[model samples]
Target chain A: MAGAGMKDRQSRMSRPKRLRKTLKIPAIFFALSLAGLIWALLVDGSSDGLAALAAGSPLMALLWALLYRRQ
Target chain B: MSANMIKRMAWVHKWTSLICTIFLLMLCLTGLPLIFHDEIDDALNPSHWVPAHPDGAMLELDRILEIALQHRPDDVPIFMSFDTDRPVVNVTTGARPDVAATAMHFASFDRTSGDLVPPPDNGAAIMDFLLQIHTDLFLGLPGMLFLGAMGLIFLAAILSGILLYAPFMRKLDFGTVRASRSPRLKWLDYHNLLGVMTAAWVLVVGGTGVINTLAIPIIDFWKHTELADLIEPHGAPPSPVALHSLDDAMAKAKAAVSDMVLQFVAFPGASFSTDHHYAIYFHGKTPLTRQMTIPALIDARDGRFAGLRPMPWYVKTLALSQPLHFGDYGGLPLKIIWAVLDLITIIVLGSGLYLWLGKGGQRMDPAMEPLWQGPE
Candidate 1:
């Protein structure tokens, strides 16, 4: 009876442990982003292609909509 | 999060991943072949041409240009690049003497003997086709923008996936994929576990690609802002300013940068150059990051070297993103690893779509009760 009760308590404790593990997702993402930023800073020349999207173009507006409309 | 917020996020995750999944799968598939393209190309049509002598004096640039121009008199050379590994030289020429023109040709030469190396028929044509399909899907700018939008959706899916992961894993371990459980549960677990492991790589490559797709606009912006003063009516006749000799212009460009090597030269009439300057593009000397360039523009009239302008932070970010996106940098081992990760991503995409569609179908079944009722 005591062992059964202990197992139940252990399972409950493990619930949030699982939740903490999920934190790795964002942690990994931010790490990659940081690495990219660092790599970008070290390079000498890059093509500046995105700055062409003016505010008036329908395509630009569409892209902005897709980017900003996060759930 | 509120119930509504959760619902909204779930919706976004479902739709975004669904829309881009197919194209992403195609890209991933085609890209796999491209990663080993050089090896594959060599394996099939082995090079037949050999140098006249290994220790012979290499041909001069002016001599090679004379020979190439002899064959095509009307065409003018736009760029020339030397290959380090092979004794080969490639010279690109165009009718209009500009990059914007489509009537351009590339001729290879045996550097030692200066003899024209005839290209093998259909060499790399299939690989080039696959690459173009992956890049623009034959749809041009609209195709690229459409893919960019998909990339943006891919980014959102990645974020929302991270959020949902927290809630789903609230009762599970980090790497526990319970294959003994129901198929749906097992796949869900696998998806979460694998997704977390590859999260960093996917985000970096995807984010950079999103920025890269914006290349057209960025170049336009650079022109509008930096080159705006030089913009003049297109019909202006050629100036009387004495054009600099190619050798002199190249030497001046070389003198501007101490350690790097010249990769190519954009002629004066090209878009990369103004009407009176040659844009000499130079790259680093190392394998770790040679694709990253440092360009110097030289005045053609006096061979005056314009100093190097470092790429802006954002633009530099885009450049570094290219290797990460293509997975061509590092080494062959890294390429293999990239291909494996790409396969894993396709699996994740497919599984996510299956889970969403399966759940939707289950909800429609009258026999099954709703998992979670919305707030009153």
Candidate 2:
């Protein structure tokens, strides 16, 4: 009975931890989208290297999130 | 969230998505080729003839106008535009100054030699076909307005989908596609995942597209209100007099705005200019400012500078929306990103269609159990 209780406790604890991990990728993507939009608005040349990085971040994040799911 | 609220949101999402999916799909497919329009044009019509004036000593604007007129004596000049990289001037002429665009004759002239440049076969017919279908479905203003309405519905669908996302994802982890489940559930996850990921891009592009569709009306309003007053002092438009030296007018316009380069000129009696003025439009050298134009109105009768007309906020917004919607401002890499995002959006749209159809016309409910709740 003690072993079953311990296992139940461990499973409950891991649920929130997995939820937090799942939240991380989306949070990063949200930040990247905001930054990219602002940079595109304020910067003079959006075609340059830095602007490309900023503008492409959302897609890149999506790619990373997809890959993370596969793992 | 409450189940009632989730149901309401799902209803909105379903209806809006269903209404706009076909039109949105058409836009994406046509937009894919438009993203690289310049490169495609260049590749198809390679410029073989070098500029006659290698030293960049361009001929007088008046002379070029005269040559253009000689080619089509019956036609009157409507607009004249300059080429940035080459010593060539493009002139548009028609039977009347206010002729419709379909009736206009366009030709290029060598700026230095006054010789007619051999026109390149740019696959114009195919490009026009794609552009017309993408822009207005060839229905003109009504088509544009209809598409604008569709764009609004698209925006509504995106917002409603976002609302449903919270409830749908409450029990599931983010980005979790249940590949082992039935195909419907698998596509549902993809639709949600890609939808949320591309939300910002869709919002901006979709919103800007709506703004762009209003361009003709906005320009008409500006002309009727602002430009009408500017030309009031000159009285009713008089009979067509021989226009003053375009070269002199161009020089004066250049003097007025030393930093800006001449982009185009609207001839007198054209929609863009007063009956007595040559509307010389100038644009800044930088990428951001290049999208905007400042008009320097010159009296065609006297070749004198009048004044620079200030653009209202709405007009400025329209100007800004052009580049933002095109995604060409950020160079090739940004364009590629736009294309990729565009393709992803297609998948999202396709998956949404599959889910709705795959359910055999049943009402979609957020609280519904997964299609494959047990082992497949």
Candidate number achieving the greatest DockQ relative to the actual structure: 2
**Could you report the DockQ of all the candidates, in the order they appear?**
0.09, 0.29
- The fnat scores of all predictions, in order, read 0.13, 0.30
TM-score of chain B of 1: 0.87
Candidate 1 Cα errors over 4 Å, as ranges: A1-11, A14-18, A24-71, B97-103, B120-123, B228-243, B286-289, B363-376
Model 2, span B174-213: residue lDDT tens: 6767666667677777888888878878887889999988
lDDT, model 1:
0.64
lDDT of 1 at B190: 63
Error of 1 at B162 (Å): 1.2
TM-score of chain B of each: 0.87, 0.92
Q: Residue B233 lDDT in model 1?
A: 43
TM-score of each: 0.79, 0.88
Q: Score candidate 2 by TM-score against the native.
A: 0.88
Clashing pairs in 1: A48-B218, A49-B214, A49-B215, A49-B218, A50-B214, A52-B217
TM-score of 1: 0.79
Best model number under TM-score: 2
DockQ of 2: 0.29
Best by lDDT: 2
